[model samples]
Target: MPGIDRVTLTMITDNYVDMLLPDLPNVTRTGLAHHFDPKTECVQGENGIALHVDVRWGRYRYQALFDTGMSHQVLLHNMKVLGLEADEIDHIVLSHGHPDHYGGLEGLLRHRQAPTPVSAHPDAFAPRYLRLASGQVAPYFNYGLTKEAIRDSGGLLVEHTEPLEIGPGLIASGPIPRVEEFEKAPTDLSAPNALLHIRDGKIEPDIVPDDQALVIQVGDDGIVILAGCSHAGIINTIRYAKQITGRDRVVGVFGGFHLGFPGTPRSKTDKTIEALRELNVEVIAPSHCTGMESIMAIGEAFPDQFMLNVTGSKVTLQAGTQPVVDLDVEARQKIGLQ
Candidate 1:
């Protein structure tokens, strides 16, 4: 259980993008100045989440692309705008079976210079449908992310149900256990009318058993958790990460908290903030499906710790130091734009 010296997370695709956001401690934003060049393109926002993670431990380094966002067009475009090369990615980690999270996988695999390892749960490829509260099940939409599609696109699938290490100090959390009573799946997809999935030639309730997260241990600074939609409940995801890694102090938690969808009670948000406070998380960046109201509330609650994570945003966490925000000039220099 050794920790890494540092980890850098870049948002290749998200639901929002604001070039006006100023940098804060540990966070660097790709602002308007980055696109000053007439030929330089700006990143676009979509209804999905994709993160590029770079890890450094001693003399070794590892890179992982977590979730491919909603579309390859947006994902690749954003990556190009951020100066990230697809060939540099060493691994791909799918957080769940949702199309928004895996939509760009095929395209990304095709763009890679070599076959890439994709770590995910077996159930992620299952045919799934949304079950409405009126007892109606929506049509199944696989979004062309079948196992065959991944392989055909030069991706080597590495399916698992238990935590797997992607690199030094980086662990892909398997299916997280549901421990919080209040943090159940969305109301429309809850038991009795749960999300539908085909299994053994029969349609059954899908609790999204494939939902997972990425846990990074940053030296003694504690663990940083990166997630997709957190359909299993962010609190549950965090607790599970802690349980599996045996690390108590949570350095940061980023990604969709899954609290803004319809039917989610306001009390849930309150409880989530309370739970996070109890954990003393140093930084929290909720994005994508983490509804705006919930995001605002969390930011208000943890003004100093909250980070506005959007497309083109990069968060850097180094061992034995507080996260520092880089100004536009410094950010440009770091990206070699100066």
Candidate 2:
């Protein structure tokens, strides 16, 4: 499959804001130093994910936002520090109904100079919850955006139950098929509620069917998948991408792998890493909910292919090549709209 000339993924907002990798070649750091050290003027990190994907095909350009992080202020702060224009975002793709992924939509829409198209699964608006260790049911709080809110923000809400061609070669996996035995949903999570499911005459864990991923085919570079949380499992996401695109080779994968946190089985990460290596995934830029143990294991195994993906990190994939792009305050100021 022929790939695009280049595709750029900028980590607009992530759980970690990198400030030490200033000398990491093409890697960029912005608006985070201030958060680390109040003395410095920079942005702070948050528990969420948001990315600005810029793809170029010949002379054509396409831009989209993968997720909107958990906080509007954090998203806005990072964008301001990165000199990102909300108006430049042609499409807003939500990974799932998770608050951390879509909570900032209203803020973004309010700031946008024009209404943008927001895409997600129909179940994204369904109430979600996390079953606690104490067996108590608690609502996943702080959800800020609703379908109505999106419409009020001048966003065209496009909900889909199947894969969609969002841009030139960019596609969003609508409902990932869960075929992997080890890749099961977090035992505690349930959309709406477990009780509600039981009352509705059903007994099954919520698989987060709304969980989806963003895909871009880089000419000759294979497929680059941007997974928001990998709640459906990273391996499942990758395989689904290959299945849907009919492109077997995966050049790069970034975003949350959901490998972190207690109660998560080690075999899950181990099996995932084994599968990724088998697939010959050239680059693994894991961040956000990917966890520290998983990151270290992947880094140790992949070595040269492992790259840190935090706030302000920019990865550029082109035909037969991939590189970390730099992002600084100066660079941000110079880049207005376009």
Candidate 3:
């Protein structure tokens, strides 16, 4: 068999935790210290959006509050609640520049060590816009992200547009290529959005340099793919991850696909859905911007494989181990609407 990647999601932060916790009685947690520190994120049963992706060596965890719709960037508080000290964090990678993705960055910097050499695309900065009906456009980020601000977050900052190995068997999917026709993430991308440009007309910005993903191998037939918002498009991000990790099969996708394009019809999404199915994804743990309708579609496509992700949710994957839990309380509460 070809190479595969394993995946897991520790709901680091978000809303709807209560609805997602009840389904977690069987989740298998191996590395968590059994002392039961309320300061740490220990989810035995309950649901919320404290989502993080743990890879083989250097895993990715969300240290910030990623819900702009809700006013809160208290990532440090949440991190403490989850029991992960910032000083313990050695490496960091960003998904985009959105407030939710970067909101708690300041809190992250409050840790003992600086998150230098944090991986992200130059496009992480720049004004964002939301495409509304009647062709209405509003500032996507009422509060835009500034590069100088991110630089001060922590550690060394290394801006790379190409895929680079960040950890053991882990690869940060860089600026993905817009090769597929399944989904076109309508970004406010343009040459003007270029955060890094040496000469005139040297690079294009519509590619959304801020958009990227993380890939890791977890088990024999598992390739866990984690995305932030997938502003790069799920298919594109996964394809790039595959290219970067050289893994042909994807066992899981646990992150925000940004499938909340309000007017996007289910028919239009079918194309992308088919692509996801083709990838042989065994789990779909979606949260944040992955809209409700889209979740239903994914549930149909994957059935029991579709796991609802929310605040306080937990997904564990071990070699030769079956899923211990899927969705927690919050997820189930929001499943049928209300």
TM-score: which is higher, 2 or 3? Answer: 2
How far out, in Å, is residue 108 in model 2? 0.2
Best by TM-score: 1
**Candidate 3 residues 242-303, lDDT tens each?**
76666666667877776765655676568768888788676677766677677767765666
What lDDT score goes with residue 333 in model 3? Answer: 45
TM per prediction: 0.92, 0.86, 0.74
lDDT of each: 0.86, 0.78, 0.57
Off-target runs (Cα >4 Å) in candidate 1 are: 132-136, 186-194, 321-338
Q: Any runs in candidate 3 off by more than 4 Å, and if so which? A: 1-8, 23-50, 55-72, 131-144, 186-207, 320-338
The sequence of per-residue lDDT tens digits that candidate 2 reaches over residues 138-195 is: 7644246578889988899999999998887889999999888889764433432332
Cα lDDT over the full model 2 = 0.78
Regions more than 4 Å wrong, model 2: 23-26, 31-40, 140-143, 186-204, 321-338
lDDT of 3 at 203: 30
